[model samples]
Target: MDEDSIDHNKSVIIDIPTDLESNQWSKCWIHRIPRKLRKVKESAYTPQLISIGPFHHGREELKAMEVLKEKYHQKLLQRLPKDGSVSNQMEEFIRDSYKEIHGRYAGLSNNGFDDEDQAFEKIIMRDACFIVELFQRNDSKKESDDDYILSTPWLKKAIKLDLIMLENQIPFFVLRQLYTITAPHLPSVNVPITQASNHMNPFLKLTCSFFKDHIVKESDWEKFAEIKEIKHFTNLLREFWLPREFIKRRNPQQKDIADRKYLYSATKLDKAGVTFKRASKGTSLADVKISKKPVLKFIPASKGMKLKLPELKLENDTECLLRNVMALEQCLYPKEDYICGYVALMDQLINTSEDVDFLVERKIITNMLGSNKEAARLFNGLCNQIPREKTFYARFYNDLNKFYENRWNVTRSTLKKVYFKDLWTGSSTVVGLFVLVFTVTATIRNVYLRHL
Candidate 1:
């Protein structure tokens, strides 16, 4: 080797120690969306009105929320005891462990703050308290007359969307810690608190309540009753909405994802004798199933089939919510990227406005976006830059593809479309067939008679 090359190798070896010392993979839960994903639809992942965490903390567009955050923080302080023990303790803890706090986010810039200064403490406390107070105030029966966010319906919804974005998050532990310290001093409004130390985690309750309207049709409290851990809002959303099957640890030896084939579009499947049914409200998005049914109850075997899909309510912020959760799965739980899998499967099923129209007609998709083409585009865009090498829906896709490939179903569907389009066409076809049969029978009879 060249002498200079040997020196370069030695320098590289020496640099490895410093890199290893700074790496904090264990603490990282908050992550920046990969550039590839961000480029697909940057607005989907970017916070629109507010920044909850350090990633987009100082953007000029979001600075307006900073004033409100400070106002909320002051309100949170007023809720605390005058003795100020909890505040002092939290401040000291953040000051001492600021590096640990900063390390929770991967690729976070220093932003010119060295160690835990007053600026850093203000940022952390304001952000954390702002969230807690927002939730608590929203939970209150009597909304404050002067409360700008709550009074403004559109702004309140915007803030909710902002909070759920992937980059706009702090470590969940920070929020919990702040809430735990202040819970005793704060008055519990809607949820009665006999003592501050209750068995139920009020922070979780409030968090779930805050996001209840957007994510699910069921009662969030009942669904997440036995909740144990949460990393952040994004993580909570992923866990709450993920299929029950993928919530558990995935088996590595499951079928290879490469072998998975995309299912036919909704319109195509409908034309192939497949019936689309909106799964019950209790059904998970990942609970998609393809079942074969007899055309008649009396018949033992038939080509009739049904595909059940859970109802999905798409709205203005639905893309943001889903993109962030999918980004979280991509970064934190690559192997168990069930949300990604679900969206990708949907992307396959929706190729055009016609497919969206079919699903909407079936009640499988509630198109609040107003246009079927827009809904179709949203589904198609979701899987951009999403890896397909592993998915929770491989088996489901395999089953769907197998069902679609059945020639009998296609032929039957074709025959139905051509011969029995409606009562008029069907009656005409039957009568024509009968006439042709009669003519053939008479011709055969006359030929036999003449031969005899």
Candidate 2:
């Protein structure tokens, strides 16, 4: 062999061991958006305001947050112990956590730093401290004049959107480690420090409080108590929307069965005698099902079977939030993709703006995205490159397909639309039918008399 080719082969042989040494799939949570998914909407997956982790660390557009991050880092240092041993402990913990997930960050550039681990350690500490400071500030009722992030309305909104992006995430463990060290020294806020310990993790409590409006109602904060582990912000957001019972009753080995051949839209489902109903209060987004009978058997209900879906509020930032969460599911929980399941179901049910309008009328969707078409496009685009091998709503989709296939449902739906459309139409149709029946009866009686 040529000398150059032999050297190239030797280098390739050495690199294989380096690759396998870092391949810890279980620890891999944070990930770059797969190219196919990113191409569908590049801006949706990219951070607009601030970059949080090593994936998008040195972007020019996000450079503004760097100075602010440093400021927060300095503040965190003042609160934390200055002892060399304590600092070393945190640094070692951060390093080990990053090492476990190093394979996920393999191709990422280290910017100007000579050593990759040194660069990431610096980035994690700064980002984690900033997040910790920001959450605590957001939780506090009183605001400081020097606090530019909270004071600037638009900036605050952008950061919230940016923080949840899959590409822009520090490992949750890093945040947890930092929070554990800083919580004791954190300045007292609205609540007494002693009482704050009542929560499973005071850090989690602060996070939930910060994002309460975006995720759930204030009354539902108690739900977080049941959660045991959180991978990162994106995962946390997904977890918030997942049904509590599903989490408790989930079977890791249980496989989902999807009928990919059958695709039905909202309008089509309606025509097939499926009555869309907004799920009752306190239901999670993952709580979807097809009910054969009405919720209240004694009370009269609409025609056909009922499909219960949780109410979805689509806002300006919802697309970004949902897209990132779906990316998280794609990377970490491919088999148990609850968020993707919900999105896929919605995409199937909303083929057009008409479907969006139909669901909006049923209160299944609160379209704040200005128009139904925009909401329809959002749902349609979400599942463009997503996989559906398994989903949380597979059984629900199967039930819907079965319900739609019944001939009786189509007949009932047709009857309701043609004759029983309104009080006047129904009454007139009933009277007209009675008249026809009476005429036929008279004719039959006359024929019998003649025969006698």
Candidate 3:
């Protein structure tokens, strides 16, 4: 063969590496819902009104929001000093931080763009500015009927839900960086950073305000203030709801329990002499505990013993919110699946409409869906995309099962429910027993008299 042919053949054969470091394969936390999971409920995973991040950036349906993003960007520029021409400086900052911002997203390099660096910088600047402005608007005290998003209740609600989706997120660091530069320029009334440290770190207060309703207590926000690194809004939200003790106790390498058996439903537990009461409003949902002793003991004790459960407010948007959070946990923190564990526990407690009704009556659950069946379906559907695991409530489950299996407790509960349900029924039973005893005595006396 000629030299050219030989060289071509040699070039075609190349050696490939067989191994790589785990870090090389690592992916970012922001991710699309796996197709297998998304198929169960596509709408729950989708953004309806707006898209915040690259996952759904250029979809035709979401294009309208781009105009709004540009409008917000213009407003952000207006905040800067007119003589300084700070827009150029801001653009330069984005351009310089291009690689760092791009690295925050997984598989972004694979997506073909006309000019990747310019496109990325533009996206990051526009999105971060839009978010900073939107949060400020939400946190503002004064009412403005002229504002479109806040004035329309449904619009505000939709935007809030969209902002927390797993795929629809920008890195929290990026948003914080943009806010640091833009905050000083905003109107004095708009920026509420009175303290120096707070001025340096303003996003925390803005985020807390945006999620005020979910916060169980005022102190919860203070707890969040101590954390230095937050991945994104959804992750922050998950952390916010977690008990402080649980957060401290979490060990990523700890062994996960392999038990996957189903626990008894609320109604079944009730029938087995386990009563339910609402837990304190400030308690974390994951901190469900069963009391070993009865809450109350009268001279004549009640039939069933009670368990204190945390109150859960169910609304129309609850399912959507929970499903997205669960998806994020499943994808990002499978080992520390706090949200998943809580949902699994709820699933065990609520199997049917009757279980929901029992919880609603006990105030353990507030149903705003207008029907118990709807609430049941919402809970039952939440676990469809995620696999069941040994939940944090495993101890409660074991204790409840042991309590239910005791024959004496079961018998006592059944008797109390059947024979002495109310005061009138107990009075009738007592009267009947007295009359029977007297009749028997008179019969015996007559027999004795006859013998005499």
Q: Pick the candidate with the highest TM-score.
A: 2
**Segments of candidate 1 deviating more than 4 angstroms:** 1-23, 93-100, 114-118, 144-146, 191-200, 216-218, 248-255, 258-261, 294-304, 417-452
Please give the range of 10 consecutive residues that has the lowest summed lDDT in model 1. 191-200
lDDT of each: 0.77, 0.77, 0.74
Give a tens-digit lDDT track for model 3, residues 360-426.
Answer: 9999899999999999988887888587655566666677777787777778777667767799988
CA lDDT, candidate 3, residue 225: 56
Show model 2 residue runs off by greater than 4 Å: 1-23, 80-114, 144-146, 189-198, 294-303, 422-424, 442-452
**Sorted by TM-score, highest first, which candidate order results?**
2, 1, 3
Candidate 1 per-residue lDDT, tens place, 92-129, comes to 77777788777877766657554535666677878998
lDDT, candidate 2, 125-174, per-residue tens: 78888898888877766753357888887888888888888888876767
TM-score of each: 0.84, 0.85, 0.83
Residue 100 of model 3: what lDDT?
67
